[model samples]
Target: MEIDPDLQGSVESSHDPIPTVVAGPSGIRPSLYAASNTSASTSTTSFGIRDPWRVTPDFAPSVGSSSGRSVHRSDTWYPAVPSESRKFEILYIPDPSRAMMKKEAALNLGWTNRDITPAHFESIKHLTGLVYKTGRTKDRVKVLVTEWLWILLQMDLFENSEAFDVRFMQWQDFRAIILDPTNDIEGWNMLAKVDCIIGGIDYSVDHSGEGNSYHLNMDELARYESCVAQLASQTLFWPPIRLARQASMKWNTICHLQMIARLHGSYTPRTVRLSTGQDIPDDVVLKRSHSECAKHVILPTASRSRRTWEYLNAHTDKYEFWMAQEYVQSLDQIGEWRVFIVGGNVISVVHTYKTSDDGWKGTVTESFLTLDEIREIVEKEPTPIRPADLRRKIVNPESGAAPIRSRARDDFMGFVLTTWKHLVARETRDTGAKPSICLFCRVDVGIRIDMSGQAPPAYFVNEVERSPNTSIWLRFHDNTMGTLADTFAMVFKRWLMDIRNPYIL
Candidate 1:
């Protein structure tokens, strides 16, 4: 079948049986099509837990239909099926003897980012696809990475990498392999071998009495620089653990207001403390300062933010930090930009937004924001900031009753571009630390066209992730460059070639 011309995922016809999955009692499994007028909307939010039950990658399934077979995961449409023949494939692994069955995945995944190209991509379209079988079958794993994963894992960089056995298993399965007591040996081996290990959203150490938390000795975890060569320990996390923390755990998120202050200006939402008489809107957003994702973030319909703040403050000894931030109205229904920087240069900016054929409901889909589109935002925006229509305000600008500060025209560099420029500068110039010492980084920024006459359009930094999730690497394009994946391949290849190559962006 052909993909729709528009950005959203759509089904032109339901006459044919597409290879989609169904959410059964045992989670998402292959099944026949439902053949109904059902569109989906994933639970992906700027902050909060993503319900994996509806974890549909291709598009959100109509889980609430009630009569349909079922709908599990946020976006669980297409599933990873085993192909008869495989060249570059992904091997869904089992903890105990998984290594005994297959060779170890090459540290560099055979090719660096530079090896990726359009010609290679076209040729491999039919050649490289996922192959997965459930039980003790000879072709059990040997699964192709391209099936369920987005561009990040499907990057031609991982060609034949799956033959060695590193694959994307669900959180529960993966957790058992790594954290389970029985498979500690294999887990230790991976920790010592893989270049880096970042526990995605689902990773967290279970706190029996108080639910699971992401405090994997985060404070004491060794720095990325120290754990490059060797990392292993039989006892859970041994040697130097190079696990990447989520954006929320980073310095800026923990102390957002102050971090913005250090930027010489705040390109973020107007944040304030409830105790300091910070104005709270009826539709306010409460941010969790110290955790991963917005685990405990509270979204209220009324302005009872003070109670939430007081509660967190009262139990400071037990909980993480909390902040009351003004909810910046979105430019699009789901407008969140994640800028992928490889060695300091912005290669791709992922735009995750909600799409719907029916307009009323839709699921979140991720795509890259091309350079041409980036230029259009500025070229298209009106010269004057439409403050009146941007958002409702409690204080009048002329009277200055609330006393608010805003960014100037020159200070803004569009939302996507601004994220990169400001983050690198803040980390290096302001913090006086080596900026982004990792192979790559992802800076998330939110954009809105609402603001005062002085600065009508505004962009704010949301996160600075050193080891961003692999999902950020989605299909990217450039009119000038035939295939941008090749560019990313080049960066990663250069780094893998020699860590001392000096372009350590």
Candidate 2:
């Protein structure tokens, strides 16, 4: 059933927190609009000057030589075409039947993992780093171009805003459904029943290559055909309907769950003004997109007749059986949820402070926790903890003690400085690069001393140093004015991106 019309006035839950893990004073960075304005020419543009795909009016002028002639001609370099390996998209499909199953069955059957996020879904923590590394517009082009065509093709795929046209199932749906994390094992096992497989099927780009020449490599296409052939030979493993239903129950439910997870993203409503100054929002409502009716069980005018026989017939298929959801625009509207699994490598380090100025203090407390300590805390406790708990166990956070002096703050800052030195030293020790630097100042000042009256330059305040000297008696102070967890979070996030496959150099 199409749910776009009835859910226009849906309201947000009052108790839910803001849908982002914002730090300090800022909100989560906003996601980009799925649609972008295209331009006629190719030229590199600066940030905020023009959209990534569009041409800008600003042009650079060439300088003349002493002879009053142009010295150098400006030429636009042609970017190389990207190989298909460098472009991919995360396709989504909704599976209501498997979502309805119990938690144990979900996990044991490989349905659900860590909290609510299914085992199949991977976290988006890697996206930012990947984008930064590749910066390829082809990734964007493939998704946007194909998606635009999918919108036009959906009309033919559906029958008059009712159920999916049984005979008109598209290969797009097959790709999406296979990628969805919530499909039931029994549902997949029943794939043999579908005419799409039994009938002579055409999924090759060659069939689609007549006009575009966007053909898959012969070796890759042969591998795909071979896999399909193997699956066909193993028909007993995934029999059609009745027999398959009985067989799927015998295997552990989690065993059927694939490593790939469902895409639980949503879309938000937005308006964009074109160069023509025309404003357009997502007003197109498609029946196949919404599932709110199934939530409320209130059939909409667009839904087909709720017939038992038809429901059962559709039950044999995955795409048609999904509960109707609503239409939205950007996927950013869907609140993200992550299931963090703990347990990783562990290391121990000691803070052998050489002097009193080697520690970091806070407004009330100080921290001596090393990165190894912090990583240990993250692994042991899956739930969120207060920033104060992450500090050195020596300081009493609840005491409400008076603030310390800037000198005391410097003394306590040793943990962070030493951690950075040790990390760089360990990682690139063989390169013969200098890794040690003054804690009070990141530069290799060479001399470390107690400068009682010395105050750092204004530029370093709230950054390299947080606590500024205010009074004579307060020689040591703490700067809990900012969240230390946030500082560490930024570092860890960057590290995660660097370590992932297809490493961003």
Candidate that would win on TM-score: 1
Q: What is the C-alpha local distance difference test score of each model?
A: 0.34, 0.22
Q: What is the clash count for each candidate, in the order shown?
A: 29, 32
lDDT of 2 by residue, 1-505 (tens): 2222111321222221212122321221122111222222211111111211111122211111111111111423422221111111111122112122232232221121121111111221122211111122422211111111222123222223121111212333443323331343333333333212311122111121223122334443333333334334433111112221211221111111111011112111111211212221223222211121112122232344332334434322222222222222111111111101001110111121112353322122322223233344444555644333433332322332233333323333332233223333332232232111110111110111111213210100000110101010111223211122222222222222222212111
Give each model a TM-score: 0.44, 0.17
Error of 1 at 283 (Å): 6.0
Give each prediction's root-mean-square deviation over alpha carbons: 20.9, 28.4
Q: Taking the tens digit of each residue's C-alpha lDDT, what string does model 1 give over 93-159? A: 2111112111222111211122233433333333211222222333222232231132334343443
Q: What is the TM-score (0 to 1) of candidate 2?
A: 0.17
Clashes of 1: 29
